[model samples]
Target: MSAAARETPRWLAPAPLWTARTVAAASEEFLRPWIAELRTDSFLADFLSIVGGTDGRSPADLPATLPERSDEDGSYRLFPSHSRRYYLVLASLVCHRPGIPDHTVQPALGERALFVLRRIRQGAEKGFVPSATDTGTWQPATAHALVPGERELPLHRAPVAAFAAPGTAAATLGMAAGQPSARTVRYGYIPVSGGDTVADDVTTTYVIRAVLVRDPCAPVISAPTQPFELAGPLDPDAPRRPSAATTKGPTS
Candidate 1:
């Protein structure tokens, strides 16, 4: 529950799980500050991999802003859920697509990799209904280092404190992998029916994707799925944080 709701009436029972409002509030609590910082700061040098749409739209095709409220035009976009989507984009640095001539950045990772990337950002909320369909393993470098039953690595420390568990660092990487190398768990979802709702309502383990950055200065869990160019111009029209008065639901 949100810190504000910690005190309840003596007559009411404690909330069994963090409410949707609580989760949304929490996501903002954790993500907004970072967004604000990123807005003014240099994107800190690093390679990046922003997710392009399933149709493979270039990152340039991605709107300058992300969906902050459920009713916004970008609401139907991927990285669904609460306003967290807005902040995630703001905190990221978009790079140029490697081989494409379009001058736009591309999302090279498959869709399932994208889902894991977002859920990790959702932090430690309880209701984790995954939006990706039919999960399977595809090994990547980080997965090799942190898979379940393996010793914890320095990068294994909570990807971010918001979504971390006590043993999340040591937590099993989940079911067996297809290869001994790090396997990527990929899934695709059709937001048509209750699709976006899963991102909002369903609670699953807040698992994040790990990038195998060899650099000592690199962040463990990151926004881009993989390293693109070392540097590129960031999106000038990236989303900004909304005021408290114009509040929306929790993505905490």
Candidate 2:
């Protein structure tokens, strides 16, 4: 069997994972600010120029006057979720494909080693029943770093308060802020699915991926991470590994 064939089918996974709406919402919450900054700093435009896309003209000049919401088409109506996809694609090229014919800039090791966390929900909830084919779509989620010793905190006592602001988190935790080799960091997500329905069995798990973020304000310049099912309680000190599973379900 080929590599693609070796991949697990989505339908075989456990039920009621992270809902699509929740994934979008969570990713947007964490990544939008950085994306907006990327647009403002002209990194996106500069990147486009470096790697010419379907239309082989430099759009490097377009971002200056374009609103934050404008995409490649120069349309003002792009939704946040849709815009993230566009940005992630740009990131994929920058991280994986590296440079084009004449560009000299390259992603640093620190930039290429950032983390993207996708939280998966399990157990039960009340809403429209989903068919086996309802596996969620593949999209990048919020990219962040874990503070030193954060994983040591117990699950219920997770240092969520420290994460109120990325900068504050760094300051309070006494580590180098941003993507630096000196700081040992990781990120996790809290499930938002328990809001509407009450289920005794509801549980949440995080699906994390290794990705490159050229800057805090940039989208992930890498391909989407594959999803995988991790059984049992999360072990904070366990080694990190990549997986390929993104399960979708009803939002509420």
TM-score for each model: 0.21, 0.21
With candidate 1 superimposed using the best TM-score fit, by how many Å does residue 244's alpha carbon deviate from the native?
A: 5.2
RMSD of each: 20.5, 20.8
- At residue 184, what lDDT does model 2 achieve? 16
Q: For candidate 2, which ten residues in a row score worst on lDDT?
A: 153-162
Per candidate, the number of residue pairs that clash is 28, 14
Candidate 2 per-residue lDDT over residues 53-78, each given as its tens digit: 11443212222222222222222211
Ten-residue region with minimum lDDT total, candidate 1: 8-17
lDDT at position 118, candidate 2: 44
lDDT agreement of model 2 with the native: 0.25
Task: State the local distance difference test value for candidate 1.
Answer: 0.22
Model 1 misplacement above 4 A: 1-66, 70-134, 137-210, 215-219, 223-252
Error of 2 at 230 (Å): 3.1
Q: State the lDDT of candidate 1 residue by residue for 163-228, as single tens digits.
A: 112222111121111212111111122121112223344332222332322222232233222111
